[model samples]
Target: MEYQEAKDKFISTWGSLGTLWGINKAMAQIQALLFISTKPLSMEDIMEDLKISRGNTSMNLRQLMDWGIVTKVLVSGERKEFFTTEKDVQELARVIAKERSRREIKPVIKVLDEVSSIKDDGTEKTKELIKQTKALHNLTQDADAMINKLMDQKQNWLTKSVFKLIK
Candidate 1:
């Protein structure tokens, strides 16, 4: 495949993958663009190249910055801000996992705690509710443990975990 075509395909594929991770299409597309760019990209450059609207580019860039994956840079004497992403794939994945654990998993764990705390009224339905919520709570706890391990380790978390398990 040709250069531009390959770039387009990569951006599309990455953007589609982002949707599966609960982010919007434009956000993922912008991430993919920043990932492959050698230099920082301005909002105008991003909109023009991605064929996205100015507002969309602005909003998604802000969101990316909030996620700590993308960051803004100043161009010497230029007013417009240029953006770049965390280039290391492992570091990027770790950051995303930490953020998702904070924003999404924590809340689910809270809800599971509340639901699992319901008093036993001696009904089959109540028993079932408690049982199911307990199961969900267990799963969330495991997820939380994994996220914590990922965030705390500097390198080879999986390898360390495997060794720990065997020992």
Candidate 2:
């Protein structure tokens, strides 16, 4: 396939994947462009390439920066900023996992804890509620522990090797 067509395909795929992960399509598309480009691109270049307005480009760029996926680069002898993507897939996964844990898992854990703490009455319904809440709390807590362990072991070669062997 032609270079531009291949690039377009990559951008589309990335954008769709981003939507599944709760990120904006434009931001992911921009990041995908930066990831494949040999050199950093200016905001104007991104806007032109993506066919988006300046405001839209700027907003998505800022969001990507906030997510730690993109970084700014100043061109030599030019005031305009360029951008690049974090090419390390492992780091990307680690950041995404950490963010999801904070955003989704932690809040769910709080709710589970609250519900599980409700006074238990003798009614079958109340008993069922207590049972379900307790089970949810245990499952969430286990997941939290697993995430923490994975995050801690992410940089350790032996830990990764062990996991691969077990799997």
Candidate 3:
């Protein structure tokens, strides 16, 4: 495919994938645009290129900053702010994984800990509920550990030996 077509396809696919993960399409599109650009982009540039409203672009950019994947930059003599994404894919994945774990898994683990700690009321239903919550707690904890290990890995952490260990 041609250059423009390939770029558009990438942005659209990325936005759709993000939507599947419960993120808004506009945010994903903005991220994709920033990632593909060689230099940091101003709000006007992003708005014009993506055809997004000013307010929508502002909100998504703020959210991206909060997620630690995007940053605001000040040019040497320019007044307006520009934005850029963490272009290193490995670092980006590490940040995203940590954020999602904190947002998603941590809460479930906390709730499971609370509910599972309740005294047994002796009813079969209550007993089952407690048992299941404990199981969920264990599973989430394990996932958290795996994510931590994966994030802490260095450049060559994934190897034939790693696959063998998993297998």
Candidate 4:
């Protein structure tokens, strides 16, 4: 396939995969574009390439920035804001994992903790609720802890080893 077709296919596939990472298709498309670009792109450039509205592009760009996956880039001698994304695949994965842990896993753990801490009134239902929630809370905490440990060891030998194996 030609460069244009290949690029389009990659952006489309990446957009679909974005849902798995808790982002919208357009958000993912924007990131994909930025990821492959030789330099930063302006909002107008993104919208033109993606055929999306200005509002949609602007909103998704902000959301991407919030996730720490995208950033604003200043171009000298230009007024329009340009944007870029994490270029290193490994670093990008690390950021996404850490953000997902904080935004999604941490909140679930907190709620589970609160629910599990309810007083035991000597009823089977109450006991069962506490038991189940406590189990879930423990499991979630353990998973989160594991993720945190992995994050702490960013770019470590083990991580590189795993990626090398996969590749």
Candidate 5:
């Protein structure tokens, strides 16, 4: 298809995928747009391109910046801010994995730790809660370890080989 059509499809798909991952659709759309753009875009440009309001664009851009997926670009001689997306897929995945681990997995692990450490009351409900929390803690800890390993592997050839083999 044509370039614009392809971009539209990409934005739509990315937006939907973002929703599935608990990210706002508009933020993902803005990310997709920046990812495909040849140069940095201002907030106004993003608003116009996405047909979203200033507040919507501003809020989403802030969120994306906080997540490390987007960065602000200060064009020389220009006062308004510009934005760009991280284009490297591996880096993008690393950022997203780290962010999710911090936001979701870490808190769950904390709760699991607290609940599992409680002194046993011998009640069935307490036993069940402890058992479930322990299991969740183990699972989340494993996931965290795996993510850490992957992130640490960065440019290691052995790590790349292992990842390929696993895949």
Candidate 6:
């Protein structure tokens, strides 16, 4: 396929996969565009290329920045603010994993801990609730801990091995 067709397919596929990462289609599309661009793109450039509204492009860019995946870039001799994303795929994955842990898993873990720590009133239902929640809390905590450990090791041997094994 031609460059245009290949790029379009990649952006579309990435946008569809964005929902799995808890981002909207436009946001993913914007990231995909930025990810493949040879240089930083202006907001207008992104909007035009994606055929999205100005507001949509702006909002999604802000969200992507919040997620630590995208950043505002300064263009020499250009007034328009430009944007770029993490170019290294491994680094990008690490950032997204860390952010997701903080934003999503951490909150759920907190709630689970709170629910599981409630006083045991000797009632069967209360005991069952505590038991179940504690189990879930422990499991979630372990998973999160593992994820954090993996993310902390930047391009470590183990991480590289794991990725290789997965592939």
* Clashes found in each candidate (C-alpha, N, C closer than 3 A): 0, 0, 0, 0, 0, 0
TM-score winner among the candidates?
3
Listing every candidate in turn, what is its Cα RMSD in Å to the true structure after a full C-alpha superposition? 2.0, 2.2, 1.6, 2.7, 2.0, 2.2
Indicate the worst ten consecutive residues by lDDT in candidate 3. 154-163
Q: How would you encode candidate 6's per-residue C-alpha lDDT over 8-71 as one tens digit per residue?
A: 9999999999978888999999999999999999999998999999999989999999998999
Winner on TM-score (2 vs 4): 4
Question: By the lDDT metric, which is better: model 2 or model 4?
Answer: 4
lDDT of 2: 0.86
Writing each residue's lDDT as its tens digit, candidate 2 over 1-167 gives 99989999999999989867678899889988998989999999999999999999999999888888899988899899999888877777777777778888899999999998899888999889989999999999898878767766657644567678978
lDDT of 5 by residue, 1-167 (tens): 99989999999999989966569899899999999999999999999999999999999999999999999989999999999999987788778888988898888889889989998999999999999889989998998978867865677634568768978
Output the TM-score of candidate 1. Answer: 0.92
For model 1, residues 23-68, the per-residue Cα lDDT tens digits are 8889999999999999999999999999999999999999999999
Candidate 1 lDDT trough over 10 residues, lowest sum: 154-163
Over 4 Å off, model 1: 158-167
Give the higher-TM-score candidate: 3 or 4.
3
Model 5 worst lDDT run, 10 consecutive residues: 151-160
Instruction: Score every model by TM-score.
Output: 0.92, 0.88, 0.92, 0.89, 0.90, 0.92
**Cα lDDT over the full model 4:** 0.92
Better of 2 and 6 by TM-score: 6
lDDT per prediction? 0.90, 0.86, 0.90, 0.92, 0.89, 0.92
Off by over 4 Å in 5: 156-159, 164-167
Kindly report which residue stretches of model 3 are placed more than 4 angstroms away from their true locations once superposed.
Answer: none
Per-residue error (Å), model 5, residue 67: 1.1
